[model samples]
Target: MRLNLPSVVLFALAVSLCSSPSLFGAEASADEKQADWIQLFNGKDLSGWTPKIRGHEYGENYADTFRVRDGLLVVSYDGYQPSDLMSMDKKGKKGFDKFGHLFYEDTFSHYLLRVEYRFVGEQVENGPGWAIRNNGLMLHGQDPSLMTLNQKFPVSIEVQLLGGNGKDERSTLNLCTPGTNVVLKGNLFEPHCTSSTSKTFHGDQWVTVEVEVRGSEVVRHKVGGDVVLEYSKPQLDPRDPEAKPLIVDGKILLDHGTISIQSESAPTEFRKIELLPLDDK
Candidate 1:
């Protein structure tokens, strides 16, 4: 059969397209793939970050506790007075609880978050005992603007970061529920904190932790590129006073929220904070 001029041109164009996949949907280039990760911490400054410290206003960086130094986001206590770091007393008085959280400006969900952190120096004078070498990455957290002036922690799921004293086997990459609970082993996990199977990280060495959060469906904690803890179904705990008011329809599922890093009296430094979004809002 003889083809018309238009048909012949169409056939030739189809043949050319089939031979060149790059014109349609080729694999992403290396630079393009790297761009997928949003560098939350710019390493030079706190450009897109805010601080909320207990007993202070949302934006107040009390005593310069949270600052950028040497290209690292650092939580230092050099500016705090010794008396300002007094421990809490029996009367539930936070003379200077000073619990602070550096929250990123935006909220996220269904993403992979990675951070490189290290605990250095010493805890502030008169700092609480439990807060030594203890810092946390607060995930799915309430907005800092909503936190009370005296609230110690935000209503969020905490990826607890701990360091060893060069002796005991203090594991890192644990979980601590401030005002939320998770489902583990197909049951509602009510405990406040649970340990992960990750190895103990001692000294001032840097440790990397990657968190895979898929809304309220599931979350995973990975250390050294290996998953050590997994859970699902994060919801507000009615028993928690701080979290009760947030319950909606008798249940407030934590599918997505803000992310923050804790001060909690520990001198910590974050070198890298990055996130890879898996879906659009």
Candidate 2:
């Protein structure tokens, strides 16, 4: 039997469409079954998220501190109240602490997180004491309920993402063991640890930060494609006093937990937020 050209073309198109269910609905079902790359932000609204400012209740009231503008998560100063501002250098401008927190609703463990961030607006007041403007991404963070009303922040390993003027050169991916500490090499350091070296990026340009975390075994931080910093067995403790609590209490486990973005003192923007499970294979 002979087939017409138009009929054969139509049949081939139909077969191709049928084979690739992604063009319809089967792909979505397949995604639900596997460890897939999920977008934390739907690109339209912050529907699945709850925002908290400085440990306050999570709700829409804090929405002013964090907002979505032009498809980017913008941390701006527009939402802060005058009373909440802190004075530095005798300046009347309120500091960034008035709106210090911006957390995500869901948490995860053993996943790869990728984010692109850039500084926005002019340099402003930041840092604790004189450390410079400090912003961070907290992983393995526990429930907010674990904190006291007056508690500044809970114990979590922070991927310290910083940006600042040339004074201190503090722009590196450091590890801040908030209420915890980790063993490095053979010694125990303070709850705070800096990367071997600091890596800096353009102030306004978007920079990609990627982290691969698996339980408490190892955590890796990459910047612009280079492995800028890494630590292994972060749960282990040295004899350092700072690490003693983290070790004795056994809060170092990174297994599965929530992820959060910080709103330190300066204005920042997050353009892309995504995650993939390590078990996708």
Candidate 3:
């Protein structure tokens, strides 16, 4: 058999594409069952989501905070009125206090969520010093309707995604427990946040962050294909007065709840947010 150089190269490229999971979408080449994988975002509109932003009524988008543009789910603060702007430090530097979360209406246990996100544009004016390129996925979040109009964060486990500034090793898909606590291994892990083992992801490039959640039993964080962090037994923090109500029977186990994306003064875009249910029928 005689093979031309171009033909040989083409064959190799095709093989690489089949083996590549980062080509596009979340868990690009995962072992997901066809019927199990559900698309959360329709890539056209906010059909299945409800927005809750600070100072706005429940379901109010509060400045078109969550929008779909060109098949991407975008968290924007474009329509914020001047009165809505928070932290007016410098002229022309606009930051709004409308910390928001766009909640997926459904709740599920024992599922895997895969989201592809990238930071875009500048952070809103007067955004917290720690929220420049900060955005995240809130797992086991509280209901949007129950949240107060001024609540900063829901009682959930945050899969914190952050981008590098320029010369620092910042990691993505780290864990940030807001009003909650979790056991990292055999002992209880505290401090609100624990950095992941993944390398720093710089720039506005799209990054795939996946979470394998098996209720309060265990949860794993993965960046691309590498398993970066894993923890178990997520529970409401009794020490935090804000989360005390969620602790029932003197023991609060977060087995299931809603999922949401945060709008913490940063512009972020999610091109794909998909989930695969691991529960047996």
Which numbered prediction scores highest in TM-score against the true structure? 1
Best by lDDT: 1
Name model 2 segments beyond 4 Å from true: 1-35, 60-63, 87-96, 123-133, 164-168, 196-198, 236-252
What's the residue-level lDDT of 62 in candidate 1? 92
lDDT of 3 by residue, 1-281 (tens): 97667978999999888767677445534454556679999899999999888777889887788999999999887776666665453575655666889999899778989999999888876677789899889998877787877888888999998988878999888999989999987888778999999988778888888899999899999877778999999988889877887777897888899999999988999999999888633
- Score each candidate by Cα lDDT: 0.90, 0.64, 0.85
| lDDT per residue as tens, model 2, 158-268 | 888776564445555678876555556555556466763646664566677888887766788887667777776555234433334444354554465667777665678
Instruction: Provide the clashing-pair count of each candidate structure.
Output: 0, 3, 2
Q: TM-score rank, highest first?
A: 1, 3, 2
- Per-candidate TM equals 0.86, 0.72, 0.84
Answer with 2 or 3, whichever has the higher lDDT.
3
For model 3, give the 10-residue run with minimal summed lDDT: 24-33
Candidate 3 stretches with Cα past 4 Å from truth are 1-32, 87-96
Model 2 per-residue lDDT at 81: 49
For candidate 1, what is the total of clashing residue pairs? 0
lDDT of 1 by residue, 76-184 (tens): 9889886776656779665447789999999988999989999998877667777889999899999889899989999999999999989999888899999999999
Candidate 3 local accuracy as lDDT?
Answer: 0.85
Q: All candidates: CA RMSD in angstroms? A: 5.4, 7.2, 8.2
CA deviation > 4 Å runs, candidate 1: 1-32, 92-96
Ranking under lDDT, best-scoring first? 1, 3, 2
